[model samples]
Target: MKIGLFFGSFNPIHVGHLIIANHLVEHSDLDKVWFVVTPHNPFKKKSTLLDNYQRLEMVYRATKDYDKLSASDIEFNLPQPNYTINTLVHLEEKFPDYEFSLIMGEDNLKSFHKWKNNELIIENHEIFTYPRLSEGQVETQFDGHTKIHHVKAPIIELSSTFIRKSIKAGKNVKPMLPEHVWEYLSEMNFYK
Candidate 1:
């Protein structure tokens, strides 16, 4: 099985994230897309993130109905400041039968060089990148070892940050989130 690992904080899984995952499974060579909900990102501020379990639950609620889309909490048990290279190594060792590839956005690709052991990631697996609504262009000039494939996923302008901000401002985000996720957030009063 060729699985595409879509790693993110998933503070609240929104439509944009689901759309990209759906696109990857349908259009790419991947058999499935696992939304790898990270407990902590070394590059991002921990204070800005929601609880790891909360984020993982939101991902599950959003993707539960989809056959090809699934959620993973693999990083929760790992050490703090989860790095992609370490996660990939652990995943490969644990699931030897599955071929794991990476799914990222073009915006992330711009800073790919700065990630820990990025060369190792590129050498071992393929990358499926979707375009995001960013201000500037992404530099796709990767070295020979990197296999970055651009996937034409529906570019939804919404993000988890935007949803959180809107919720904090007492705005209705029913349309931005999946039905189950929105219900859970409203009942829990998350981000308020």
Candidate 2:
């Protein structure tokens, strides 16, 4: 199977995420897109994130109805401060028959050069980048790179941070989240 790894914290999975994943799977050659819930992102503060399992549960709920989309806790057990290269290597070791690629937004592509062992990652895997309304130019090296593909998915401006703040301020952010995820968040009183 050709899988596209969409890695994120998924602080609380939202509709925007589902849309992007759905677009990638349905519009691209990827067989499925896995939401690799990160346990700890080296770039993000851990305190700002919900418990790993809680975030993963929200992802599970959000993706449950989509056959082509699924949640993965692949990075949960990996060493802390995990990098993409590490996860890619580990996943390849475990799923030898499957070809794994990356799904990222154009914003991330601008800073892709800073990622650990980025050269190795580009050499080994394909990158599927979607458009984003973010600042900064993509590295000149990536222009027309064979391993990198720019996917014309919708420009979703919604963000998990905005949803979290809205929920905390007693706003109705239900429309921003999946029904099951909204129910879970409401019942658990997360972020409020």
Candidate 3:
């Protein structure tokens, strides 16, 4: 199986994420897209993030109905400040027969050079980059990763940060989230 690993904090699992995953599966060569919910991103602020388990549960709830899209808590067991290279290595060992690819936004590509073992990641896996609004055109040139290609996924301006802020401000964010996710967030009063 050709799987694309869509890694993110998924603070609340908004609709923009769903749209991108849907587009990848429906329009690209990938057979499935797994939402690898990262426990802690080295570059992101930990203070603003929800608990790892809560984020994982939200991802699960949001993606439960989609057959092609699923949530993975692979990083929860891995080392802290989960690096992409380590996760990819672990995943490759666990699923030997499957071809794994990395799914990221063009914005992430802008800072690709600063990641841990960025060369090794590019050498081993194919990358599918989706356009991010206001991030502008990113240079995709990198050594040993000629398989990388730009895909026309939906460019929704929605972000998890915006959703979290809205919720904290007591604003309705029903349109930006999945129905079940909204219920879970409301009932749990997360990010408030």
Top lDDT prediction, candidate number: 2
User: Per-residue alpha-carbon lDDT of model 2 for 139-192, expressed as tens digits?
Assistant: 556889999988988888999999999998999998999999999999999998
Choose the strongest candidate by TM-score: 2
Provide the RMSD of all predictions against the true structure, rounded to 1 decimal. 2.1, 1.7, 2.1
lDDT of 1 by residue, 1-192 (tens): 999999888888998889889989999899999999977656676675888888888999999999999999988888876688989989999999999999988778768889999888888899998887764456655733348888888887888899999999999899999999999998888899
Clashing residue pairs, backbone N/CA/C < 3 A, model 2: none
lDDT of 2 at 54: 92
Q: What are the TM-scores, per candidate, against the unseen true structure?
A: 0.92, 0.95, 0.93
For model 3, how does the per-residue alpha-carbon lDDT over 1-192 read when each residue is reduced to its tens digit?
A: 999999988988999999999999999899999999988655676787888888888889999999999999988899776688999999999999999999988788778889999888887889999998888776644623577868988898998999988988989999999988999998898889
Candidate 2 regions with alpha-carbon error over 4 angstroms:
41-45, 136-139
Alpha-carbon lDDT of model 3:
0.88
Q: Is candidate 2 or candidate 3 better by lDDT?
A: 2
Give model 2 RMSD, 1 decimal. 1.7
lDDT (Cα) of model 1: 0.87
